[model samples]
Target: MTQPPPPPPNQPPGPPPGDPQGGFGAPQDPPPGGFGAPTPPPQQPYGYPQQQPGQPQYGYPQQQPPTQPQYGYPQQPPTQPQYGYPQQQPPGQPPYGYPTQPQYAQTPPPSGGKKLSAQAQIIIAAVVAVALIVGGGIWYASSGGGEEKNDTAGATSGASQGKGGGNGVGGNGKEKAPANPQAKLAFQLPQPKVQDITDVSGSWLTDKAYVKTGVDSIVGYDLDKGAAAWTLALPGQVCGASRHVTADNKTAVLFEATKRVGPRFYQPCTEVGVIDLTAGKLVWSKSVTGGSAGDTKARFSEVTLSGTTVAAGGTDGGAAFDVANGNPRWSPKPNAQDCYDMGYGGGAGLVAARKCGPYDSQYVVIQNLNPLTGAPVSQFKMPPGVKYASIVSTKPLVVAADVGDTAGDGSGISDFFSIDEKTGKLKAKITADADRYAARCRSTEVESCTKVLVGNGRIYVPTEEHEGSSGEYGDETNEIVSFDLATGKPMTGKADAGDKYTLVPLRMDGGNLIAYKIPPYDKGGQVVSIDGGTMQATTLMENPSDDSVRDAENSFGTDYAEILYGNGRMFISDTMLSKPRASSSTKEYLALAFTTH
Candidate 1:
């Protein structure tokens, strides 16, 4: 009954001897002098029971039921490395197998005893091997094995938390979207009453953005801080919303009101609402009629702004409002039977209107009206058969063409001219090969056409290529021909081109043309910095895949893709509203911004 030495601190007491369960602790390594193969079992002492049939016959002891069955030791094999057991044994080690041997104590061979036969030695050796296996399993289960499994369980729980917590990389990687480095969540959109084909409609100023949530509400989000700056909710249901942002990004007009009519009819909202974006308040909401109700032709109803003048016209004619005070500057007689296209002539310091009497007719009246007084600065009749015309530039020049004319359309070949801003008289006419002049610009009088860029005293137009020619992909054309803005003659010098990439001039950025290179379908696109003074082109940054932009469009119901430049920053987003089916898991909207300065 002498006591054994106690274990070191933090170690559990070993199981009692003859306690049925084997002792629990680190298993002793094999003696340095390896145990020679077993010789034979020692003879039983007098009165010891004879070995029973079908029972263990080797010198091994009888099997003992596990003291703690809850440990489940020996019930299942440990597949992973446990305790100090190597994950995989070195070559020639005993292969892991069933615990065939029984536990037994080591006793020195009986001195001078008869050496056992070969068969007896084999049985004895096998028993010793099984004993080691069973002994190792029992020790692992009792001491810290339960805790190890628990640690594993805890790790699993942690992984689940990371997936659902809405933190960084919140969901399954393959199924989740990567965060956009260029933009952040400015704000969550309010619960939409109706999830229409359109997503959140928005427009951007320098540091702020105007987003139309639902039908009647406009929320201004601060782009720099990624938070809402202000929100204005108009009375009555609103639809067919369109936005016009000021050059300064401080003011905007949301032409979203009046229940929509048929596609061609526009019922202008009772009043147009002009928002002072920086102030986050409505600058003025005044009575107006003939605003668009989703009519493509009735776009005349949409609000238009130029310089400091903000104007909205409809079948009810047109009116100008002071952007500074929102006071009425001038308006035509109400219910006039004409459609007028209003826009800012930034270069001329004026606002002009082109009124078509019968809609898309061959000829229309053009007037360079004083934005402040609403009086004509000059008036002239468009050249006969001029099906499409826009006041693209205000430096006393007029450019007109069908944009794209093929032999079959019978829309006469595209022609351009320069006219006097003061006299509204034709000044000069110049021509380029219709097939080679690939400025297939949009016919809308409001939106700027990519094929024609007016800036830096030169008009940059797309030159064409014959079908199957190398430049057939005009978008991939690097060199663009420029024309003198004043003389209607081709300007000298070839516009610098990108390598195997066509450069399209979007707008004038300082003395450089802020433009983008049209990437091949699905490849991706990039913004280009064109030095207009030298026609030198330098790419700015590669844009995200067209798919990402398309995803934004699908979620937002945007009608067109656009790149907006302001405050030394580039804001690229979808414009207009048209619902396109999208994946349900897509983010609600996407706005990408890049530093341009």
Candidate 2:
């Protein structure tokens, strides 16, 4: 395999040779006057065509400066295109490196669909290998350390409620925003050196501590000081974690039975367990094996929590265990039609994506399941040509899929189907253009989508970042829009990100939408609360504009980053970590926290 040359120093690695150049990168040095500082309007914005001087500028106002620089000022010319703005590709090309066909995981194609030739399969495998290498290289070259903090010595504290009034669990949308929300750097966790790319995707916030998954252990840090309060060592690395946490701060995870050895680089993810976030201990660990294939041990790809049930699903089949005592609830059994549960969605409810029928014409059946019983309450069969379906929300019953391989962007979504879980009937079909909407779902991981959210009977998603009205270099922005779940019609208002700032939907705060604004090179990021009805925005927390802080925040791009905001504090963490480049000097952090108090 031919390796691409390393990117220029401080610059993020670009896409492979035939791939398009895009995605967020490290922050660059701010020009004179600093970001968000007052500046005179330019004669014309870059990229866009020039207009007459008298006409009002399309983006930020040139005459009156913003009250506190809510949105950043125009950035200086970039030696290269900064993050968020992707260069356009020539016509008649794949959007990204992914092939046009819809990829399935551990499953065969539908009866009517064409199968990939042996040669094509090899080509796809090579593409995947190159992608993994490039991905690891990006982290190696782009990672840098942030403001240091003492994290080794501190007394453990009991889980407490967040400052204002809410618990730090699920952002239940009841936490009050501070009146004057000015955030400062709270603490940072230094990245641990690793010999290979490692997965560390889980993080949770509790009133008393912020718990995160480390390489081979889970650590709880004091909320204010960022010191390691307690650590629970594990026998193997965490393979999957549930984003949902119980009311009492209990979550679930899937892991391997043993550590990866020399020739055994890949280990089976067969262990299932529940973690007590408040107590910082693994409550119980176990593994099961069953199903038509009669495998010795079940390897799960995803795990989720619903009420007291810890449900896990994978290629072999599905299993559920009691979250409290790890008692067996149910396991896959031989069925008449050769059906098996591929994955499950849990949080407000428990739903399963079941694949059945013969190999050539296999179709997916979405079932709203009884969490404790593992029985289908109601089921809806997906249309033909739909290879896979992801559950976006279980309560309202929203499923996303790329019908007939038309999404083309590898986002794993082209349309959203709203169904009535009680009746198992389709209510509406929402057509979300892949190029227009920024939401995405992992092709195989049913519950692994981000950037799109469902709440208050509506679906919220951000528009793809486009050229800002400023017409200046690196002035790109986006906004949040919505669609009614019942009718699938466009909603009335929108939350604008302003110029040079990209807005991403984080979660819902009561009737307001909480979002993070990715600023230009010179400015710091901001967390804002947008009114659900009026679409107006309120600044919740603004970060420091210092270079080191900005770099730390920018290191975790919103696309693949895990962001948790609650109790007047925000945490940005990476889902994966890689060995730093031997020649690099910049420090790297596993996670960074900011607080408004």
Candidate 3:
């Protein structure tokens, strides 16, 4: 799901192929001395490469490269104010923030491909402006919030799995690795000056707090002194959250009922609430009107939490409530082949992704519901061009798609079936290869997806950062590999990420496999643990390459960040929040944490 870095050899040619405000075609403003100082590319170090005099540049330890451009996306001016993905833009582009071309065009790596780095094309233009303004779903459970139910073929029992396979409710719990861990920085959050591109996404981690989701409140912090400790506020603006908490820490969101006004700048995610992350509050909020596209209200874009239900979904459909007292339990009724649900994949059970016929033969069915009778106890149906799917794991029932679109790399995934929720059958498909995998899946957000990971019966995945046998200007690395959800093959072991680092996997910690790593640019991030069998990694916490904490951990770029290691800490946030680069003063952050104690 990363892709964009190819243009570098003589550069300057972008913006023609459908240049509706240019994305890969570069240029959208900020060049001629505006990014607050753009003269650093004469000899070596914007994205590094050009050292033949005596060669020899191996790994880490080479500091000295920051005379100005502190972190990314500055150099502005097309009137300058863009910030992206609030949803609904398509008319001549120009919205999703940062990527105004600061020289790229190195080209040359196609017959074997690998080159990429100017910090990976500024982290693939901030993950293509957060895959075009965040789509939805990405909760994966069982860090130990506990629900442990696996079996429609996921075959549970890797100490009771739950990280992308579900049911360990507000999950994330296996800490214990400490010995030498190393961490430091412990708290940082500042980056709120936003007036546009906002949606602070979400982030959790309980057993004392860490919450986050601010632009209309959720706060929480204080796990080891980051402070705040509780906020919850809300009246509008947290348009969706719910990576399924609830082993008591409860969880569910999706807001916006008012608050934007100037021509009503988007304010209809309806409402649907549930918070309570160990008492940080919210408890209940509701909004449903009718569904089947009728009384109007509905709106949601995604929300989950199984067992006690909650649900939510959108395109004007799917409802469900009762996380303890919001009550409804099911709504959105009208059906008759118009089929609407469109999103849902809560932990441990309850799947959905419906979207049936009509808009030009559109398909997508995948049911398996019954989280208190939303009905369909098993379905399937996707095939035929598949406009979208992405479930990733409803008890081994995985899904992900992009099929006929052939994963042109916007990463809705290019395949990963594995069904069998009792009898929906199928079981093993796999096929990844979106330029050698780095899993993604938000094409339309049926539970979003990222670096993928379904547990023990195997799925893992990582691979895409390439180029690293160490010198010639070496160091880029990446590797996790696993696949074998019953027999889609390849799985003898992998884990790597060493050289300049990049790993990412972040879940499943019973049979082991936690991962995070990123580092490089003078080093610091890590979290390791691997060994789901002997993939062997183990570091646990690391963080702190000093230089103001590696420039705030390289400005949270692991594809639109949010990361969240457990116990021995690690947090990192930012799901989009623009408005600081009037030509760089650097200093930006919305979340950060690290610990090791």
- Top TM-score prediction, candidate number: 2
> Top lDDT: which candidate number?
2
lDDT of 2 at 149: 9
lDDT string, candidate 1, 359-471, tens digits: 65434445555555454444445434455555555454455544233212231325555555554544444343343444443444332333555545556665442222254
RMSD of 3: 24.7
lDDT of 1 at 315: 43
lDDT of 2: 0.64
Weakest lDDT window of 10 consecutive positions for candidate 1: 146-155
For model 3, the local distance difference test gives 0.60
Candidate 3, residue 321: how far the Cα is off, in Å: 12
TM-score of 2: 0.71
RMSD of 1: 39.6
RMSD of each: 39.6, 19.9, 24.7
What value does the lDDT take at residue 231 in candidate 2? 97
